[model samples]
Target: MPHDDVTTPSVTTEQNNQEVLDVFGKHRDLASLPVTENDMPIGLINRAIFMSQMSKPYHRELYNRKSCIAFMDKEPLVVDAAMSIEALTFKAVEYGEKALADGFIIARDGRFLGIGHGLQLMRVVADMQAEKNRQIMHSIDYASTIQRSMLRPSREALARTLDDAGLVWEPRDVVGGDFYHFAAFEDGWFAALADCTGHGVPGAFLTLISSSILTQAIEQRGPRDPGALLMAVNRGIKQMLGQLDGNDETPGSNDGMDAAFFWFDNASRRLAFAGAKSALFVLQPGDEEGEIVDGERMGVGYVDTDLDFTWQNRFVQTQPGSVVFVTTDGLIDQIGGPKEIAFGKRRIRETIRGSRHASAARINEAVLDQYRAWQGHHRRRDDLTFFCFRVQ
Candidate 1:
C-alpha cells in the first residue's frame, strides 16, 4: 500500500483575485489550487470556473479587485498526507466530479501540507500493486523449486528397486497439492500417493509437510508395515495442522488428505496396501481385468476422524511379470469427453486391460495417450499423480 506523496504547490490567502488569476496564467498545468491561511487549508479554486468568470464581460472588472476568498469555494476535498492509496481511492469516488476538477487538499493535522491530484493517486496505486504481484510470483517460483527437490531423491530409489516403472506427476498450478513417494527398504521397496486438500499454494504447503512426515515415519517404523506409516501420517498431519483436538465442528476443520500406501516385501513376495479414501490396482500377467483393492472408507487427519484408529493393510502376493498401479484422484476426477463427465476408474481399468503383460512404462504410455484423447480441451480439475511398477 506504499505510495509516493504527489502534491502540487498551493496559494496563500493574501493573494487577491487578480493575483490568483495571474498565478493561473503563469502555471498552466494546475487544474486546481488550494488556499491556505496561517498555514491551514481555507478553501479551493477550480481553474475552469475561475477562468470562465474572469473572462466574462465586466466580470473581472468587478471581482479582480475583490479578495480571492470571495471567488474561492468554501468547502473542498482535504486528504491526510499519511492516508493509504486504497482509502484515498474510495474518498476520491465519494467526492465525485469535483475531485477530478478541483482535486483534493493534502493536509497533516488540519494544516495545509500540499495539493493532491486524482490522476497522480491512480498512477501510484497502479505501480505499487504491480510490484506486489511481482513479489508474490517470485516466491511461488522459488517454492516450486523446493517442491521439485523433494521428488529427485525418490526417483533415485525407484531406479534401484524396479526393473521398469513409470511416474506421471502434474500439478494444475505451478505448485500443487498432489504428491508421491518411493524408496528402497532392506527387504523390499515402498511407494505412496496422496491428494492433499485444495491446490496451488495451500496444497503445496501440505505436500511438503506430508512428504516430510512420510519420510520420518518410514525411517522410524520401516517400510514393511504400510498401515503403521499411514497411521503415523494421519497423526503427524493432525498435529502439524493443529486439528488434533478432534473437534469436527470447528469452522475450518475439513483440511486433510486422501492417500494410498504400498509396501512390497521381497522375501515374503507379498504386497501390503493401505488406504484412506484411496485405492490401488494389481494386474497379473495375461489378465485383461485385474484386482481392485479398495481402501478404508475414512480419510486421514480430517475432523471427526478417529485419532486412535489404525489403517488396515491388505496383502497381495506378487506374480512375476505383473504390474502394480497407484494414482491420485486427479486423473479419474477430470471432467472431459463428449458427455463432460468424470474420466472414471472404469476407463483406467480398460486402458490397462489392453496391455496387462507390458512393462509399467509401456502401460503408462498407453494410458497417457487415451487420457489425452478423452480430455480434449477441458481444463485440468486438480493436481495429478500416476505411478506404476512392474513386479520382478
Candidate 2:
C-alpha cells in the first residue's frame, strides 16, 4: 500500500511541547509525530522519549514552554511516497536499528505524506516476491509445452523417412530461436534447420514465421530444386514481414533467419542443398576428412529489393554409406575450452572424421559429448542444433 494511506499526526516546529503531548494523548497508538516547516518534515518526536524527558526532575519546568523542535530528533529517516515497498525496506535497513524501530517518514514533492513501519514493509515485499515467482514458473511451464508441440516429430514417421538419422537440439532457454522441419515430398524428402535472429521468446516467434513460410514454399512450389525453394521462401518472408522495399538508407524489419535446406532423392541417391549463411558437411566413405558445402553468404531478410539476390544450389552424388550433416553456427561459435576460444569448424570436421564408422545415433551422441567437454563449466552462448543422415 502507498504511504498516503498510513498518515499519522504531524506538528509544526513552532508548536510547544504541550501541544505535541496533547496529540499523543488523543491518539494513544501514535508512536512518532513529525515536526514540519512549510509542509516539509524537519524532525520527528517520539512519544516515549518525550514522556521520559518529562519524568526527569525539572525537565518539564526547564523546557515545556519552548518549541517542540528542542525535543525533536534533528536527523530522521525519510522516504518518498512514490518509493516501492521493496526499496523502502532497503532504505530502512540502511538507517540502522534505532531508526527502523522509530519508523520512517514518507513525503511527496517535499511535503509530508505519512509514516511507514519497517516491519510492515518487509511483510509486503515478501508476499510480492512470492507471487511474482509463482507467476513466472507458471508461464515457463506453458511455454515449454508449446515449444515441444512445435519441435517434436513422430518416431514412426522419422523412421520411414530415412535409412539412418540422428538429431540433437538444445535450446539456451525453455523456448529458443533454433528449430528444424522435415516433410516428405512427392519426388523425395525435404529437411531444414534454421537459427532465427535472437533467442528466447522473440527468437521463438520468428521460428514460427520462418517455419510457416518454408512449409508454404514447399507445398506450392514443390521441393525438387533446393535453390528455387529457398528463393521462394525468402520472397515470402520479405512480403510477410513487409521488407520487399527495404534498402540500406531506410531498411525494413531487420529480423529474419539463417537457414539450410536439403532435398534427398531416393532413386538417384543424390543430395541437393541450399542455405542462407549456413553450411552442410559431407563425409563420403573412404575419405579421412569431411568437406563443407558452403551456402549463400547473405541471410534471408535484409537484402535490397532492387538487387539480384539469387541463391545457388550444390548437389552431391552420395554412395550407399555416405553421411551428410547440417548444423546451425551455435555449435562452432560456442565459447569455452582452456584457451576460452570458439569450438570452431576445424573441431567439428575432426569429430565427424573420428565418428565416421559409427551409427548415426552414436555419431550424434559423440559430437554432443565433445561439445560438452569443450564447454566445461561455461554457460552456453546460444541455441544448438544438428541433423545427420546416412544414405542407404
C-alpha positional error of residue 153 in candidate 1 after TM-score superposition, expressed in Å: 1.5
In order, the Cα lDDT scores of the candidates are 0.85, 0.82
* Poorly placed runs, candidate 1 (over 4 Å): 1-28, 42-76, 84-102, 246-253, 354-359, 369-378
RMSD of 1: 3.9
Relative to the true structure, candidate 1 reaches a TM of 0.82
Model 1 scores worst on lDDT over the 10 consecutive residues at: 1-10
Report model 2's TM-score to 2 decimal places: 0.77
The sequence of per-residue lDDT tens digits that candidate 2 reaches over residues 1-392 is: 44435457899987898788789889898778888999998888987998888779997888877899987988899888888777777777888885667778888888987877656676787789899978986887687777768766623345678768988888888788998888775567888888988998788888878888887887888877778877877787777676766334435467778889888888897888999899999999988776889998888765453224788889999998898888898998999899999999888888888988888888888889999999999999999999988888
* lDDT score, candidate 2, position 12: 93
Top TM-score prediction, candidate number: 1
